[model samples]
Target: MVEAATIGYTSFPGYPEPPYALVYARPDRADTAIGNFLHGLDLADYHVALERMHIGARVSAVFAAERSALVTDFHWVLDD
Candidate 1:
């Protein structure tokens, strides 16, 4: 499975929702491993992996959609 995480984000009244960065990984590697691992999938896959193995980690933008205020920054750890 592929783990897609939103490392960070940015938002404002006149600014687009920045995609930020996503740390990508996979279970196994083989011929065309990258294509098979990353392609022919959707974001929901990440959610599933996150629930099952807690493989994915995300730190959203510090912006509150409702109040348009920046929230506190977020951090995480990965050791496996």
Candidate 2:
């Protein structure tokens, strides 16, 4: 898994504001299998309030067999 965080005030056209923990997986076909284990978690509640917190968020990816790349899928949720 590759983890990244926003460095500055960044914004996408339809996405949330800065301060996002982006996580994705790029496993070798021989080492890792494809399954729900690759999915991430949802920690928006903690992320918004804490500056240095653990990386946990619900994530999904669209694999491109042609290019062998993981396309990041993002979703926002409010925890109760």
Candidate 3:
């Protein structure tokens, strides 16, 4: 993964923002896998995502694959 600060963002014809910038995936470092993960989750609820991420001692997430990533200290609430 190459590391560089985001110079700018490019958006497509229609979408909230074309996902051109980084909100979490190390904006200073250009990790391809990290970038892809962030982009893939564009439609996810930011508040819920952050809430899930915050239960830890410190918030952290690691993605080996998009379907599941390692998140620290997160608790799950199940629905019946």
Highest-scoring model, lDDT: 2
lDDT (Cα, tens digit) per residue for candidate 1, span 4-23: 53322455453334422333
User: In candidate 3, which residue ranges exceed 4 Å CA deviation?
Assistant: 1-43, 55-80
Candidate 1: pairs in clash: 62-71
Listed in order, each prediction's TM-score against the native is 0.21, 0.27, 0.21
Give lDDT tens digits, candidate 3, residues 15-80. Answer: 236433233333224343232222223225555544433322121244343443344222222111
Model 3 / residue 64 / CA error / Å: 6.4
* Per-residue accuracy of model 2 over 6-46 as CA lDDT, tens digit each: 32246767444554434332333435422222222333555
Best by TM-score: 2
What C-alpha lDDT, on a 0 to 100 scale, does residue 44 get in candidate 2? 54
Better of 1 and 3 by lDDT: 1
Which 10 residues in a row give candidate 3 its minimum summed lDDT?
71-80
* lDDT of candidates 1 onward, in order: 0.32, 0.34, 0.31
- Model 1: residue 60 alpha-carbon error in angstroms: 22
User: On TM-score, who's better, 2 or 3?
Assistant: 2
